[model samples]
Target: MSNHKDEVEFPKMSFLLMAVTTGFVGGILWSLIGYLCYYFNYSTIEPNILLEPFTVGTWRESWIGIILTIILYGIISIGVALVYYILLKKLNTMWVGIGYGFVLFLVVFLILNPIFPSMKPFLQNDINTLIAAACVYILYGLFIGYSISYEHNEIKYFKEKELKR
Candidate 1:
């Protein structure tokens, strides 16, 4: 029997592009969920919370600020995707995604947010907002994790099909 690595076979460019596009989609989904929660008063958390430093009086004055926040979050999401991709070889992607989302919640909410004085009040809110934010992150995590799994399978199948030809 030959030992072959269950490899993630794809061009680096394809992987990078996929990660970025997935991140973009995740960001859009996150923003939509955030706004919905805001509308319902389920949570006061906003997508632009970390962007407080970059904006002046309001986010409306500078569209660039909004765009920048999205882009930044997208980049961060790539890190989440990377973790999923790395662990996909060994474990279930869905569970890994959940763990990834939880870790992200801990890192951002518990660790990073407290570092910024501007974010203090937002983080200090009651438990309901935390639950809402956790839900949002878990959903985003599931998207990235499943997406990577699906994309990887597509690429692998194409390669196998080509070999058969």
Candidate 2:
């Protein structure tokens, strides 16, 4: 049996496919939603503009940029999902997801903004843009965080039930 210092330990599944899949789905969904918000002028930041640091040669300004950006979002989210599964999977609370998303907002906007020349400081963006981005991030976090924790709890419940049998 596994042991957690603060929470009940769960049985290990043979694979962690749920986390990976949730990452891609959450990533693509948030990127598209954010882009739509930008398209409708509610947000000033282009969803793909976060990729400015790794893209080059006018590519970021091209149609391919959007596709690549979405793919990158999926890739990055996989790691982020894995992190949530590892660190916060046992928390059993949705607030953790909201807090996690807010943390991500801070990391991306305040900490990582300097890495992307096109990104403005957190205080510089208008309220709408900030709200739009925050909502998107929070939604993404809720998706990943809630799903993982729910699954972990479900598995733990089943395992305990089986043990009692």
Candidate 3:
């Protein structure tokens, strides 16, 4: 019984640590994927594909761009984590995580991409960008859903055991 009670506490510090770590890792991985596509001349942006084509000479430039992009993505990832946490707090289910992920992608596609001139080119007659966005969002959703569900389950299990006592 005491063990169950202890479990129910679910070390806040640890959960937070895990969430941050997962978010960072997920962000980095997705960024790397995007970078690779860009580096290999597989990017949707015609200017990027032609002007400063991805090559050893442009490696440094690409690195700088990718890193900056990744940082931006990391910020988005943090927001995603926060949203997931909030949804879990309110709904107590992982389904909201999935919806949140889709919403994030939709906003990027419909609002951000269109409004941002730089992003306009990527979406213009480019299937790759769409595919990339889909892939990233799917992975992002999976990561969020898994992380949130895992945490929620752990807490719920602990609470149940505590009640049994």
- How many Å off is the CA of 74 in candidate 2? 0.4
Full-model lDDT for every candidate: 0.71, 0.87, 0.61
Candidates in descending lDDT order: 2, 1, 3
- Clashing pairs for model 2 are none
> Candidate 3: global Cα-lDDT?
0.61
Query: Can you write out model 1's per-residue Cα lDDT over 1-165, one digit (the tens) per residue?
Result: 645586566645586578667877787678667767866888766666767665567753266666676677777776667766777623436877677777777777877786555555544777778888888888887788777777877778888999999
Two-way TM-score contest, 2 vs 3, winner: 2
Alpha-carbon lDDT of model 1:
0.71
Q: After superposition, how far is residue 94 of candidate 3 from its true place, in Å?
A: 7.1
Better of 1 and 2 by TM-score: 2
Better of 1 and 3 by TM-score: 1
Alpha-carbon deviation at 65 in model 2, angstroms: 1.5
Tell me the deviation in Å of residue 46 in model 1: 2.2
What is candidate 3's lDDT per residue for 69-88, written digit by digit as tens?
A: 57756666776676666556
Residue pairs with backbone overlap in model 1: none
Where model 1 places Cα greater than 4 Å from the true spot, the runs are 1-13, 60-68, 86-92, 120-123
Poorest 10 consecutive residues by lDDT, candidate 1: 114-123
What's the TM-score of every candidate structure? Answer: 0.73, 0.87, 0.66
Residues 15-72 of candidate 2 have per-residue lDDT tens digits of 3788888888888888889889999999999877767777667787578888888888
